[model samples]
Target: MADITDAEHHIVAASYHLMKALQTTKLMSSDVRGILEKLDFHLSTVVKINEDEPDGDSIRELEKSVVSSHETITSLHLSYSKVWASGPEVILEYLEAVGEVQRSIEALEGMPLSRMSNGVLEQAKTTLHMAMERLQNELIHILVQNKQCFEHEYPVFEVYPIYEESVISNEDDSVEDASLKGRSSSETEDCAMDLIHPDVVPQIKSIADTMFAAGYAQEFCLPFTAFWKDVLAEYSMILYVEQLSIEDVKRMEWKHLNSRIRKWRVAMTRIIGVYLGSAKRLFDQVLGEYDQVSIACLIEASRGPLFCLLNFGQAVLIGPHEPEWLFCLLDMYEVLADLVPDLDTLFSQETESLIRIDFHELLSQLGESVRVILKELGNRIATCTSTTPFQNGGIHPLTKYVANYILCFAEYEDTLPLLLQDQEPVRESGDEEQNMDGEADPNPACALAMYLQSLTSILEAALDEKSSLYRDSSLKHIFLMNNFHYTVEKIKNSKISPYFGDDWIRKHYVKLRQHAMYYQRTTWSSLLTFLHDDGKVGKATLKARCQHFNTAFEDLYKSQTRWVVPDPQLREDVRILASKTVIQPYRNFVRKISDSIGEKHIKYTEQELGVYIMDLLEGSSKSLSHSRKR
Candidate 1:
């Protein structure tokens, strides 16, 4: 019995030394296992001693049970120490060690010892729970370090040039071979990926997965929300197309913009897939601020392109060049409609309404801009009603701009009808127009056609107002002729023929011809009547008539020389008509007057008279007076 007591004392002594060793030095996993084995043996020895002394004093048994409880607590402390040494990478093994500690506490509680072991069991459970919390915090610390990756501002928006293989000078050069030709060297420069790189989404997703696996999924939410919000804010600033001035837009190149938009759409789609897709929807369980942040990101992705178009439209309205932005906006819209589906699918109804509302607003603003410019031009035209000659011939100075605007409208001939479709009345059944794929469009109403028609009216009214600016009746007719001819030529040369229709153009052309005929018939008819009826007058009166004819011709020639006829064909026709009007009558007058006066009272001969008439119609009055020797 004494030897048995000594063995128990030695067991207690060895466990004490083991606990001291664990407290002093950092022990390896194997060393911890060995220490735990030694502690386990001591605990069993106490329990065995308590069992063997069942007939002894109850106080001795209680003492043995107390010694066994202390050894069990020491084993738990040793396991937790290993947790700190191994760190978060070994978190799974650490959890298993914690489970082992829990089972040991239960075993100790179930033992037939004194009720005081209950206090030790409870204390063990409390300590293990606190240790687990510490380990979780360590895991969170590791993830927080990873979160620093998103601290810097990345370029979320950028433009790059899209290059295609150049046309080879030699027909024999293959596409691949031609691609090898360089500006100054023989090496080719192939198109590379975007400088921002496309792997950003994958990198973020990989980190998120790793964090979830480390049991820090919930803890990751705060940092992720903060980081992503920063990303969105940064992206918003970089791609803020609305902040651009007219000069900035003037510097924009469409191909580069198109290329950047394409790549950006791709990136946006990928981010949506990562954050909202079914497989790893990291934001599904996140509520409150995180959820709002996630939704904000989606909204920005869907609305960013439209905002770009809006800003571009505004810039176009402010600048002299308006057509290019509209053209590029339409192209980008078409490309996105075909390429991107997630934006439509995610916010189907909202996207439709937003697109239509935004587009209509853009059209309304553009129409107003067109109206203002045309109105200003009309005011200028009203003020130009004077005898002064215009700088650009008979045509209005604004004709070039108006023609270009009309042609711009014509470029969207196919698109206009679709955008201007009549809005069907809302039914209780809620039926709507379906696209080719049989999906009903959410917003089907557009007034772009009416807006375009209004712009056309403004343009037409401005042109008509300009035509009335000429004071001379003949010059007014010439102004109308030149303007109508210009309109007809622009329509014929461009796709704008559709807007005016064939009949409208044909009718305007007829009006133009009638104006030309009126100027020819009425302009010189009274002048030609004087040279007629030479038989009714005496020789002296006929000589006076010849002198009056010379003075009238010079006055007419000097004034009409400054009156411009821009079109070559029309100018020739006017000259020919003028010749027909006066040439025959004047030649007859010269003959009759020469015969009647017999070159005695006549101030000019028939040959010199013929040359004067030629000069009058040919618009070269400088040499008319010098033709006396002829």
Candidate 2:
């Protein structure tokens, strides 16, 4: 056992020494790796330095190029003051000099500035700066000299000829003509306005390229943006877009304000669609090498006028929510909606996203305003009341106002759906299926239809309340019948008929007929009872009944003749219906009673009664006393 323990201790000691030796070796290996990596890095740096060292020939060539470019820039700077006055060849030489300096600067960029001797690098930079300054001045001069005169009388709504089929059918036109013909009016307008003359674009682009190469993009943008901004402002003034605040709009009378709103529509369309679009094209043409810079330039230059137009819409949005303003709001909404695509295309860059967002928010606010105005109209109609009823049971003012208002909405059928799209339609009981047509989500048109239906229903309820002001029940029915008939007929004849649907018209027509029937029953039924016999056998009784009939008939004729049914067709229909109801029964009773009581007891022949019934609703008062054959 002692020998076995001794061997175990010896094995443990050997293993411990071996593990210590292995760890020492690993540390030594790590030190060698660190040394090797340092050696490799130093060797690579030496090789890179040797490789970057310029040869004598290349250095001489760079120096020569710099000297030549400097000479060109210095010579061009002498003529800078008269750059525009000089011929095109001088302008061309100046642009070439600017380009040569830019290229020399680019070639020097690869060399270490410290390597150049005798201030060569500094001299080159100074020469390039002077060249860029000259180029900048030349660019401004060319832009100013070539800018197209602002034509104040430019047509606001000119339809381009290429959009017409006559222009499209010409086979001799170029590819550009075909492309122009294919473009929509808005797209055509995008390129229609030229800020600078076509001859100057190439010269401007050359200067722009030189400036951009020399890292003077900001300097290039400044004058271009300023010139276009002033032009856009002038264009705004020409379009009659006044710089009015919300307070200004609020204070103006509606007549003057209406004119301004119309001008705003034209101005917004022209500025955004034409001027901004043209400016974007100019930037792309001049600074096509730098997209971000060009887009930034456009946004900065036109931000003022663009937002000026948008702020007008915002001002109108915050103005009063009167019923009369509804159409104007719709007009603004439509114009904005139409321009959204153009705005998206023009302002799609990240820098111009804020303008896009502002427009979207304005569009949303205008839509909300329209909804508020429409809801207020409904509220006004619902609460509309009168202490005095219409004198002759003609169509009520409320009905006329609402019918005309709803018909106007039909004119905006294409635009209202987008505004009303987010609203959950108010579904009266049993209208859900009709409105949704078995779909869970109703289309925008359905929502608009539902809204119109609700409005008309509110108007009907208002008319119903107003009808109670009439003291006579027959005139109340006449009032409702006339109003309902008028509303239905107006809807039936106008463009809004589809939104109300055939079912709605048919149902209202039924209601109108019911009111007519009510008028007949209430007015003529009582008078009809006089003609009926109650089993009286004596001739005196018959003669007394005949005299009572004549007196009641004459009184009814006098009072109701003055009442009106303004619609001629409706008037004829009402008369014919009364004739069928009262005239035949009246003729029979008069004929039967006249045989027993003699001709003197019967005051009116059936022919005379027919004539009187025909004149019942003619809106005139007449007396039969003079014409009575006593």
Candidate 3:
């Protein structure tokens, strides 16, 4: 074996200098020169090891030097002042490692005398094998440490980039030509609604400069790239697309706030970009990628503003206080629905996707997160655990917007199609962009409106005028229990999502917001009944509260038409309620109760609190019977 000191010398020296390089941000000529000199030292040693027989000594030296070079390169990469600063340098280091082995092989076996020997072949094979292994380890380190670089899928949502005629031909043109021609008109319109401006380049560079100058990047390269790559500038493209879409809105000069609608669509694009990443690629087919031309078209259309066409539609269709916004929102929903199925498939099936959390475990986590955040937000809004409906800012802003949009858009369900095709024409794609504005382009029905109506049915039950469960404490609890079942079923369904996604969908948002109305309504009703001081109300109301709690279980069990099997405890608890109390006089009273006017404001809250209780209780008889048979 090689002397331990030699290996330590290589490793310790590299580590120490890397620490120094990472600590210093002022890459004065001297600093740059010093790091360059250290880089040369590691490169020289690695190259020398590759040329040698790679006995234990040489192998150790190679490993140590490679480790140090990797460290230094990684540190420098973290502090990249511009795009060129990091990615290019990393590629260079990779090239250097590869080149060292190639150079060593060439040097040792160039001549005829050297090439013909079996001894040389054997030694060369061993050396190359060792070198490749080291290289593999290095590559693995880079990928694991910097997986965030590839984390976002926004960039990959476009069509394929390149293809051959024998493979992905699009009828008339060669694959290359066809791909080059790029995205469909409506597709480009979607893309344009998402592009970022080149103008932000200078500002991004400036921030990089400050970080590089401050040693922030060197100290934390992974986080540095993450902050810039994932957070700060990632949505720049979306903003650019928004601006471009506005330009289209200006060109069209349509009536009734078409420009404003464009703005909202642009905002929507940013929201998607925040979750999905900037890389756009085509769906993987059995043969090869089919997104080539479409991918480019997506990027180009997104080059202006995101969803400009939606904005145009909105401007044309919706007027303030008019019923048309519902229709326009439905159109947007249709487009969005077209985009969701593939995304759902990707999360459910793709190995590297972020949506790979276990649902039950995730739901558990969401429960805890929502409690903490909603309470905190509740505090901010001057509310509490016992506060009644219409509190806590009336749904978090994003949720409010999405839900209200869905609710309003429900009216246009008839106008939308049951199924939507993914491809849509953009106004840009050269002459075709203008041509799409013409009446000749097929104006298809939206898919969003239909989905929204189904969603509306669930909420409508909470808000309906004649519903007995809307205000009755017992009714409210049971309805919320049913709602929880409904929501869980939605989570399991093929369409729509309970969350936006892994990185962005805080566990708190789902539990706190989705269940907020139910939680508020039920909790307030339960508490008020416990503490109500009306003189004549006495035991009658209190006993009814208890029976209502039990009947709430029955209501929840009935709601299980949506579930494959209602959670078992729900039935057991209902059975327990049957044994403990006889509600001879109250059954008719329970039947007579009507809907609460305040239900709409507190729907999610009541549902939240009720679901929690159901989780704690036993299931109805049907659920127990089914379970026992199973």
Candidate 4:
């Protein structure tokens, strides 16, 4: 050290300052090591110290270090995070700061910490514990913000289709258009979830993985739970919007809602599955009840979107709809069934029980819906028969409607047995006839058989009603014959007859023949009675009988023009049978009094009368005089 200039003095002072700084750094390192060693010592022997032992000072000293370390970490996190900035860099720095505090606790934890007393270790562990919590909270905030941004940018919320009066009609064109319109809306929503933020799920999983590595599996549960809550909330919100936007489901065409529900179910499964399937362990932990109430909130929150499915179920069960509604519902349930594994893989026994209850309820609702549709089909059958009574010999329009409805019944054949479990087996007079004739083989008991039985009952009742419309016994018999004949023919022509059995066909056919025979006996036998001529009768009396015959035939023919005998063969048979009854007797009588009838200006020659009668079978009546020789 020579006597130096100002620059040399400044250099000497600067060197001293550098040396002091190095000494201070060394002291700081020693202090850090001493703190770490003390932490390890406390962890190692704290539990071995009996509460009766007089070592309060060491325990207090350790507690103070833990508190101070916790405060330092809190302060550091606040200082860095106070900038309120965002992005991967900011997130990484925050994670690093939290991880630094966690590493200290992990060092202490490695030193036989199981022997540590709960009171002392709990205090020392608080720093890392709180840091993990803060880290989790920060990550959750980031996740929520990310989700909010995704929602804002993509707006994937479901938009419920509106049904103005224009689409509500039951007209063929309107229903078809409404169906297509509904499917289009569903397709639009199908893509609604396709555009989610790419970073959302992965970022959450990354944070969860970090938390798990820090021995904070429970801490990981919180943020991931929050993440899933946000995800599910979004899903529920979309469903809510969709449910609200749905028009009167009970009254409007269901095709649109049906399609919308199917699409929504698929979207729900896909979106929820995307998360649950991706991070199996994370959700499994979140779903676990490590503590009694730890996961109750998550379980309850998970059920939010499921309510929409239940709502659709409610609509399906209670609404006045057809079995087609049930078909769509089953499709939706299938989607839900596929979705269950994603969530169910995580379920605890208690949670599984809860979900099982919900499923049981849903299944019960489905069963109820099936029953309702079956009942409605029965009611519709009654309505059809009541309103469109068999008119004219053409099959009742109701019969056609019932036939088509039976065909509709075929759609639910798979499910109908379940519905009918609570119902009485359908029995009908036609079915009984089949059993009596040994044609009622035990075909596998099925919905088709039950439906046909019910339909046969309805048709039999309608035929009875139609037969009552005519006052003349013979006409009544003919009306029954026509309706029965038409019904049997339709059954034979359609796919439904096998359900009724061949003997059912034979029974109705036999009844139709009986009716025809009865009509001949009741309506035409009187004309046959007149053929029993006593030779003792005078010309005046015979002429009287001829006039009487002409009057009766004219009355009968005129009154029958309105009657419908739809079967040409049956009409021809009746006409020919009547012709034989009238013409042969008249011809014999004419032979007996040929000159007398020809001489007296009889109203119709036998040949002209026969031609006039032929017109009756053709549903037209030419006046007997129109057939008179011109």
TM-score against native, each model: 0.50, 0.79, 0.24, 0.54
In TM-score terms, candidate 4 sits at 0.54
What tens-digit string does per-residue lDDT give for candidate 4 at 67-186? 555546555564565212356766665566555545545544444433333454655465566667666776666555654322322223343222222211211112122221122222
List ranges where model 4 is wrong by over 4 Å.
1-101, 109-202, 213-302, 308-355, 365-405, 421-451, 454-470, 493-497, 520-550, 565-596, 599-630
Model 2 ranges with Cα > 4 A deviation: 1-92, 105-126, 149-192, 434-441, 533-537
- lDDT tens digits, residue span 393-471, model 1: 3665445444544555554455544544443322325433467888655442223333433444455565566556556
Instruction: Mark the 10 consecutive residues where model 2 has the least summed lDDT.
Output: 174-183
lDDT of 3 by residue, 1-630 (tens): 233356765775676566556546654665565565455444334323322343434344434444454444434434542223345555455445444544444544553332122233333344344434433333334334443322233322323222212111112222221121112233323331222333333333333333333233332233323332333244444333233344454455323243344344444434433323333322111101322332333323232233343344333332232222333333344334444443343333333432322222232332333223322321322221122321111111222222433332223334333322122322323322123556433433322322333333334343232223234443444434433443333343323342222322244235324443453444334433433334455445645554454445445444332222133543445433422222322332233231312222121233333443344322222322222110
Candidate order by TM-score, decreasing, is 2, 4, 1, 3
lDDT of 4 at 123: 52
Look at candidate 3 and tell me the lDDT of residue 253.
38
Among residues 3 or more apart in sequence or in different chains, the pairs in candidate 2 whose N, CA or C atoms overlap within 3 Å are none
lDDT score, candidate 4 = 0.55
Candidate 2 residues 76-170, lDDT tens each?
55535656457788877766766665665666566654443223445557667877777778888888888986556734343221111111122
